[model samples]
Target: MSVATLSLFRFASLRSRLWVIGQMALARRSAAWAGSARFVKLCGSGSGVGFTPQPNWSVWAIFAVWPDEARAREHIDRHPVFARWRSHAIEDWTIFLSPVSARGSWGGVNPLIDPSAERASRTAGPIAALTRATVRPQFALAFWRRVPDISKVIGSDPKVLFKIGIGEVPLLHQVTFSVWPDAESMAAFARQMGPHARAMQAVRDEGWFSEELYARFRVLGTAGAWGDKDPLADALAGAAAAGRRDAA
Candidate 1:
């Protein structure tokens, strides 16, 4: 089965028009490149809803689909655009990749974001980092545009390591869920010339999306699965699972 890679980012210092501009340039270019590789189907960003203050900023979503984990790993390991851009841009990068086991609409299901709900999401757990923190009833498509489709004509062949599902949550904003060999490998990529790093700089420089970003990485157990493999469902389920201190 194909897996999903979800990532969310929160930038403490990302609150300026200049940063937004820089992010745009990077996103347009990155989208063009990834589009050529046939890895990304949709890419966009926006602000928070139903939540207060919103995050300083968030990387709304960076989602893609791949054939498998090995392919996804290889493509990420040897992407030219990523290698070239990592030199001057990007800093303080962190990422999370969760294989989605489910999918569903968060517009009405979330408790914290809903006006009439009991706020069930407020309950805390051990794996707090792996659960939903911020809640958005409806996602705002604030910064979005096209970079054209010249990559396919150029014949830039690229493959994916895993299939990805995009999710939107208030706390874990700008999330990307992916399956990697281990947390160590995921951490290494974050430290090296990874797409997350490149995109971070791009967003900071050109302001690709409307919000800032914050990410976390977690390993899945046999019982760990996203609800209906939906990104939003996966986030909620993951959050709940992370706090399961009694699981065997």
Candidate 2:
């Protein structure tokens, strides 16, 4: 089955951050790894909390999709980029996921999850949601103006375990990754008749995004910690309980 991993890195010092930035730029020049054998697609991005364009130098992230879990694990264990990140990051977290549902594309290619993958028999577990978009130049101002309020709504929701705003370029290319307790909770926040809903309508009406992708994943497992605790611990535990009850 197709597997995906999202890794977060936190650098405590300025020097480490600069080193990572240089390495990220250098990675793009090496064409040999462009169509890597193990990973189907990979993206490295700067992490931001809200809609702001400013770079958060201290934290960075890498999202990758693989043909299977074994290859994904092997790449993480041996890849040079991962090695460099390990050396620089003071704290890091990685989560493994399987596609629950996906639509749209990233950079004109739908890489993270395959739509044809068989659905899990259980659909009520922890959910990982990803939304990516390339903003049209003309609509950039209007798009960003509506972000802070929508972001606030998502960020303040108690059901959301973890959330981060990341992008390749500061303003034009943006993505958000969030983990929720369950699919229902995620839907509740997303389907709310508020700024979030209005923003979705604006995207469709104003043609704000030149390209966009929205996807959901089933959380398989996670390694390491964010802020000294596994952010999805509670969600995972609840999923485990549900699985046990179903088995019984």
Candidate 3:
């Protein structure tokens, strides 16, 4: 199956941050150089969990999709664009993920192939979810008005291993990514009756977005750390230990 990778870069100084920010447009050519690349995106992060309007100049990310893990790993290591950003970053982390379930569209179509929901449910590991949208110009205010509450809701969830607000365009195009210990915990939050649920209802009733995509992933592995830790380490380790015991 196809795989996706999200590589995050953290910079210390204002100069480095600005330089990475400029890569949003500048790095496209280099990213396109990959012969087998399926999808490529350069993203800037938000303050806090990424819902706020203020940009977090210190952190930036690159998201890509490849045919498989080996090719994805190869490109990220050799790609000049990624190399340039890493050279300036004080810290960098990359996590590889496999899609379990996906719906709707991303940039007109979902680039990654998703397995059945049943297959996703059977997999025992850390779960990651991605929600992306392009807000209709007319509903931009109403759309943004509900973000802080959603951010607060996710931020307070003890079950969330990692969460961040990242996007392509500053206001109109946005994406939220989060990691959970399992599918059950992740689904609980999505079904929780609060700002997050309310926003989903509003989207269905009022149609605030012109385009959207939602997907779930299984954490395959990690190459580096975020906030000085591999956020999914303990949970993933526990899952692996259980699997080993069951096999024996």
Candidate 4:
């Protein structure tokens, strides 16, 4: 099965943090792991929503799609870039996922499994949602104008366990990764009559993005915590119970 991994690294020193950014950029183009990886993206987080033009020098992230769990594990365990990150980062977290649904494209290609191919055995597990965009130069102003309001709507939502805004470039290339209590809860928030929906409508009406990708994943497992505790602990437990029931 296809697997997606999201890794976050926190650095203590500014120099080291900046150095890793350059390293990740270079690795994206030249690393052997990148060659084998289905999709690879190096991202920076916004201070508040974790997706602004203002740089967050202390934290960085990597999002990758792998053909299977074994390859994803092998790359994380043995890749030189991963080693480099571990050496400089004070703290790191990685979450492995299985695509439940995906739409649009990243760099013009969809790298997730088709949702129809997988059976929807249960519907109570945590849902991981991703929304990314490469904004058109002319639309940057309009796009950012709507961010704060829309971000507030997302960050304040009761269903959201965790959410962060990340991007390769500050404003132009942006992405939001969020975890919700369940798929239904996530859909309700997204489809609600709010700033988020208005922003989506504006994006379509104004042709805001040159490229975009939106995907949802099933949280298979997670390593480490976002803060002091696992954000998806309850959801993971629910998933485990569902799996056990399915096996019976």
C-alpha lDDT values of all predictions: 0.33, 0.76, 0.81, 0.78
Each candidate's root-mean-square deviation in Å?
Answer: 18.0, 2.5, 2.2, 2.4
Question: Which one wins by TM-score: 3 or 4?
Answer: 3
TM-score between model 3 and native:
0.92
Model 1: residues with Cα > 4 Å off, grouped in runs: 6-20, 23-61, 90-100, 105-248
Whose lDDT is greatest here? Answer: 3
Off by over 4 Å in 2: 29-50, 113-116, 120-122, 146-148
The lDDT-based order of candidates, best leading, equals 3, 4, 2, 1
User: Highest TM-score among the candidates is held by which one?
Assistant: 3
Error at 24, model 2, angstroms: 2.1
Q: Give the per-residue lDDT digits (tens) of candidate 1, residues 33-56.
A: 553333342222333221222332
In candidate 4, which residue ranges exceed 4 Å CA deviation?
Answer: 113-122, 146-148, 245-248
For model 3, name the residue pairs that clash: none
Candidate 1 lDDT: 0.33
Worst 10 residues of 2 by lDDT: 35-44
Candidate 3 minimal-lDDT segment of 10 residues: 113-122
Tens digit per residue, CA lDDT, model 4, 1-248: 78999988888897897788787668777445645577888887887563467677888898988888888877876778777887888877788888877778887789885554684634557888898888888878877777545566678788788888888887798888988878888878867846656757677677878887878887877876666677777778877898799899
- Candidate 2 lDDT over 21-66, as tens digits, reads 7866775454635544334333445434445566778888778787
